[model samples]
Every structure is written in C-alpha cells, then in structure tokens.
Target: MTDATLAFAHGDPHQLRGMEGVGIAHDGPAPKRIVTGYGFWIFLLSDIVMFSCFFAAYAVLLGQTAGGPSGAQLFDLRSVALETGCLLLSSFTCGLATIAAGVRNERWFQAAMAVTCVLGLVFLTLEGREFASLVARGAGPTRSAFLSAFFALVGCHGMHVSAGILWLLTMMAQVLAKGFRADIQRRLLCFALFWHALDIIWVGVFSVVYLLGSAV
Candidate 1:
C-alpha cells in the first residue's frame, strides 16, 4: 500500500490509542462518585448510631407506665400485623423496581417504583391515623414515659419512611428524564438499602414495643 494510503487507513495515531494529553482531569480532590458513596455510607452509619441510642432509651423506659396505659392496653397486634405486611410488600416492590432498572425496562421500573411509593404512603398514613386515634383517646406521647418512648421510636422510623418515599420519588424523576444510567442505578440501590433498613428497625420496634410488651 502507498504511504499516504497506509496513514489514512491507520487514522490519527493518538486517536486510535485514545485521547492524548487530555490528562482526564480529576473533577476535585476526590473522585466525585467514590466520594459521594463514602459520604452516603457515613450518613448511614450516623443513622445507625442514632437508632441505637433510641433503642437503648426505649429499653430503659420500657416499663415506665406512670399509671397510664401499658403496651398490652394500647397496642393492637392486628393493626401492627397489617402495617408490617404493607411495609414488607413495599420493600419487595422496591426490589422489583431496581431489577427493572437494571434491565433497562423503563415502564416496569416506573410502575414498580410507583407501587412501592404508594405502599409506603399507605403505611405512613395508617401509622399517622393510628397515632392520632391513640392521642384522641388520651394515649398520647405525654401520657407516660412508656408512651413517650413508643412514640419516639416508632415515630422516628415513620419519619425515615417518609424521607425514603421522597427520595424514591426524586429517583423516579431522574430515571424518567435520563433513563437507568449507572449513577442513577447506584443511587436507587442505596435508597433500597435505606428502605430495607427501616423495615429491619420496624421489626425490632414491633418485637420490643408490641409483642414482648404485651407478654409483660
């Protein structure tokens, strides 16, 4: 082959090998994605610490009824059962949504995510109504130390669920706009972790505040 033809066939040498002297700039001191993930982990750890403290406080205040309604008098196991089922189903839907994202099935992802969010909202609504009814019946947080602990522990968990719903909605918007890109998928996974962690905490609350408390 002629020299000119050979060079044309090869194309730009640097281009073929990849960009030269581009020196892929580090966006900042730390890689943006790695730093973001590390920061999220730290936040989750801090949350764990907070939950631990709440758990300890609840334990200490477990039997302090102060002449008010005790867990056996106040807790409705049937309602708690329903709430637990709903939250568990929501967690399942969230998993399905993540799977849909991985497969790049936008419709399934959106549908599953919407279902998850709806279920989460339902759980929160039920919890709020339950709290309201209790308070209306003169069993509010101020009723006794036990009630106060109950409200704080369970209420904090409900707040986490609320925050998670918001986060899920935000991620849904991102997915709709950008489609399931890697970064967005990662964020969704993290949100899933957070959601499931809330479920775990609820299990503990249910056992300590409802089941065991009833037995006592």
Candidate 2:
C-alpha cells in the first residue's frame, strides 16, 4: 500500500493527519461561553498587570513629597474604612446577583444588582469626597510626586469601579429586555468576572496604599 494507505491502516486517517487533535479532541469550535470567558480572563489579566505597574510606581514614589503632605498626613482612616465596607458588601451582593441569574430569578436578580449598584455608588461618593478633601488641603496630584502616585493608583481604581457600575446597569437593562438570553448571560458572566476582579484589586489597594501608606 502507499504511505497514506499504510498510515490509515495503522490508525484513523484523520488522526494520522493530526486533524482530529487540532480541535483538542473536539469536533468543532469551543462553546461560546468558554471562548468568551477565556477571552475575558485575558483582558482581566492585562488589567491586573497594568495595576501592578501602578502599584510599583506608587511604591517607588511613596515618599517623594516635595515639602508637601504625605499619605499619613492626609489619609483619613474613617472614610477609607467606610469605602472598604461598601465595596466589600457590594461584592457580596454581586455574588447574590450571580446566584439569582443562575436560577433565572428576574426579581431577585434585579433587586440584588440594584443593591450592588447602590453600594458601588456609595463607595464612589466617599472616594470623591476624599479626593475633594485632599485637593482642598493642597494635596492634589499636581502638588507632589507622592500625591501624584497616590492619585494615579487610587483614581484608576475608582474609574474602573465607575465603568463597572455602568456595565452593571447595562447588564440589568439587557436582562430585563432580553429575559436571560444566552448572549445576555454571557455578558453577565463577563461582568461578574470583571466586578470580582475589581474587588480583589481594591483589597490590594486597601492593604498596600491605605494601610501601609497611612502607617508610613
């Protein structure tokens, strides 16, 4: 027999050609959900890397205040504590929203998401007030390298939270209009991943920036 015939006789012709394993033992494309989630995770990882760079920059410039206020001088533990509580609680409500979505419970899902949105708003409001207070006290980003690093790190996180809130609202509207459609569900899953990621990043910020910065 010819080489092709011999190879086919030894095993499956497609396997011999390596075509069967090309799909990773599957016959077609991966499920949409898996593909979407994997892509979203890549995006999340890139975001994390960016935040890590910001953190490193902040650390390097932590004490670069040119005769200006430092974090320990300007940091308010009470407001930071309240912000932390709101964000952490929002993470919990976000979990409940995910659970409700899984069960296709529209009412509960909406309610949970609404609560999450409210908590996120509260967190942002507190952050905004804190920023305003800092700026009023001549500690704005332009005041010193230390303040610049602090604002860049914390402000970036706040922008992400704001974006997440907008995305959360969009998800709510999509679900209400589409009734848990597959695409809607996929978007919701991505949103959950993004939101949870923000929560984790915030924890890091709280520990590194707020806690450590305040102590120093």
Candidate 3:
C-alpha cells in the first residue's frame, strides 16, 4: 500500500478513538454552541442597523416641530432621568445574571433576570404613561413631523424592552425546567446581550431626545 493509505489505515481514519467512552467529548466542538453564538451576534448586528435607521430618521426630523409642541415643552427631564436610572440598573443586573449562569448558579441567575425584567417593565410603563399624557394634551405623533419621529424612536425602544421582558420570562422557564443546559446558557447569553443593547439605546434616547430637547 502507498504510504498515505498505510498512515490512514493505522492512524484511525475516523479519529474516533480520542473521543471514545466520553459522551461530551464525542459531541466534538459543539457546533450548536458555536452556531448559536454566531447567529446571535449576527442578529444583534442587524438590530443595531435597525436602530441606526431610527436614529437617522430622528435626526432628520429633529427640528420639524410643525407648529406643534416641541420636545422641550413635552419632555419631562425628571421622568426621563428616572427611566434612565432604572434601565441602567437593569443592565447591570443582567450582567450579574450572565455571570451567575456561567457559574451554574441557577437561583442567582433567575433572580437577577427577574429583577431585570421587572425594571424593564417599569421603564416601559413609564414610557407608555408619558405617551398617553402627551396624547391627552394633543401632542400625539400625528400632531407634527417632530412628534412623529419622537414617537417612532421612543416607541420602537419600548417595544424592544417588551420583547426582552418576554424573553426573560422564557429563559426563566427554561432554567427552571432544564437547569442551565448548554443551549439554555447560550440563549441566556444572547438575551443578555440584547437586553444590554436596549439599555445603551435608551441612553442615547435620553441624551439626544430628552436632554438635548430640554436644552434646545
């Protein structure tokens, strides 16, 4: 036989011996884990692109007050500041949840995630109330181009938070049922990244849409 064929014959062509008797090792590189991470990152990038478009639209319409209420007149800086703090704290707790997951501390992970979800819900509630109050005062999105843009930007973010809350609950269920399996851990990681990204987006909203609105 040729040298190549001899080597292949003698060297375990299937390369299965190294993984013999080890179930986890037989799994080999965990393609699911790798793909999960990659797919989640791609999703996050796409989400960032979507948010960028919203930001650009807001920028284009920032000054289009159209004889309606301006941001300074409609925005409540104190409320915005409170919402910002809640989101920031939720982001921090989400980080803690991820850390707990990594350590396989299911209790801490679930608690942290629960806290994050509650804070996210509170933020959304405040935002909804603000919108309702605006509409009650005749400052709805249809009132002007600026209000339209404002509603689009802030409302899109609230929707994201709502989605995150749903995801958090789902993850909690998974943790309770599965005890932080590898796939569950991967999903939690993705959720953590998404939740934190929403917090960062809210920071931008508060700064550009609220703080600057107050100043200008």
Candidate 4:
C-alpha cells in the first residue's frame, strides 16, 4: 500500500485498541481463547442483567400472596438445602475439570465433568420435585403474584443450570472427539465461567428468595 495510507493506519488512535503498541499491530486476529472468553463474559453479563430484573420483580411482589400460600408456607428449606449442596459440589467438580483441562489430563477431566453433571442432575431433580409439590398444593404460579415472581426468579436460575448441564455434556463429547484442541479448550473455559456464574446466581436466589422470603 501507499506510505500515506500506512501512516494513517498506523497513526489512527482507534486502531490502538486492537494493537499491542502505537504502531505495531497483531499479525492476525486476537487469540481464540481471549476472544472467546471476552464474548462469553458479555453473554454472562447479559444473563446477570436478566436475573437482576427477576430479582427486582420478586422483591416487589414478595408479599403479594393474593390470599394464597406464600414462600414461608410453601418453601421446603430441607429440600432447598440439599439442592444447594448438590450445586456446590458440582461447582467444585467443575473447577477440577477446568484444572484437568489446563493440564491436558483426559481421564480426570472426563471424570470430574461426569461428576459435575450428575450433581447438577440431582439438583434439578430436587427442584423439580419441589415445584411439583407446590403445584399439587394449588400454590402454582397463577395462584398469586408472589408465586408468579417466585417461580420466575427461581425457575430462571433452574433453566440456566439445566443449560449448563447440557453444555457440560457437549464439552465432554467434544473433548473426547477433539482431545483438548485449542478451540475445544476455549469452549471448556467458557463452560467453566458459565457454570461458576450460575452458582453465584443461585447463592443470590438462596439468600434473597429463600431466606429473606421465608422470614418475611
């Protein structure tokens, strides 16, 4: 190209965002892992924003029982505690899986991921049972504003967990087929980030929706 064009390109301040230095630029696109992680982080932030709205709705409608049962009457603390344990254990195993991925240990990665998936399944099962019991008691979402908000907030988190379980299995399948290829590793990293964020959101659910709601 011409010197003037090159000068304009090299001197453009906007280009500095992608360049390592003022004049020098990366030879190719950003590393796949970094780009993948950044994109997934944005996805996570958007998910959090969605959950924040749910939290606000639940908070506002917390006391709107409409003459039906409320959280204090419907929530089974024992079941919720067990579900929390399962998720916490799954998160731990997920961390181990991430470490195994970093070390390129196929066996440990598969085993840890399997354990995480099982724990997540157990969590979902317990949550499903709890919802069933509530519905059987005529305390379904349509029963009251409180029930609707409660179901929306908790069910959103449960849906994320369900998606995470699916993603974990997909990651496992790809690892077996691809054997930790760079792209697969980046996907695994994103999976870890997504799973951990779910756990964080669940903690909020436990604290605000369960603990506080029960007391109120």
- Structural similarity to truth (TM-score) of each candidate: 0.81, 0.87, 0.84, 0.86
Off by over 4 Å in 4: 1-29
Q: What 10-residue stretch in candidate 4 is worst by lDDT? A: 15-24
lDDT of 1 by residue, 1-216 (tens): 754445448885655345433453434486555666777778888998998888888889888989888888887899888898899999899889878888999999999999999999889988998899889989999998988888998999999999999999999999999988878877987887788888888888788778987875
Local distance difference test values of all predictions, in order: 0.85, 0.92, 0.86, 0.91
Candidate 1 — which residues are off by over 4 angstroms? 1-39
Alpha carbon deviation, residue 139, candidate 3 (Å): 0.3
lDDT of 3: 0.86
- Residue 44 miss distance in model 2 (angstroms): 0.5
**Top candidate when judged by TM-score against the true structure:** 2
After superposition, the stretches of candidate 3 with alpha carbons farther than 4 Å from their true spots are 1-31
Q: With candidate 1 superimposed using the best TM-score fit, by how many Å does residue 96's alpha carbon deviate from the native?
A: 0.8
The TM-score obtained by model 3 is: 0.84
Clashing pairs in 4: none
Q: Report the C-alpha displacement of residue 40, candidate 4, in angstroms.
A: 0.8
Better of 3 and 4 by lDDT: 4
Per-model tally of clashing residue pairs: 0, 0, 0, 0
| Model 2 lDDT per residue over 1-216, tens place | 755556567877565675444333536788999999999999999999999999999999988889987789999988899999999999999999999999999999999999999999999999999999998988889999888989999999999999999999999998998899888889999999999999999999999999989887
Q: Pick the candidate with the highest lDDT.
A: 2
Instruction: Using TM-score as the measure, name the better of candidate 2 and candidate 3.
Output: 2
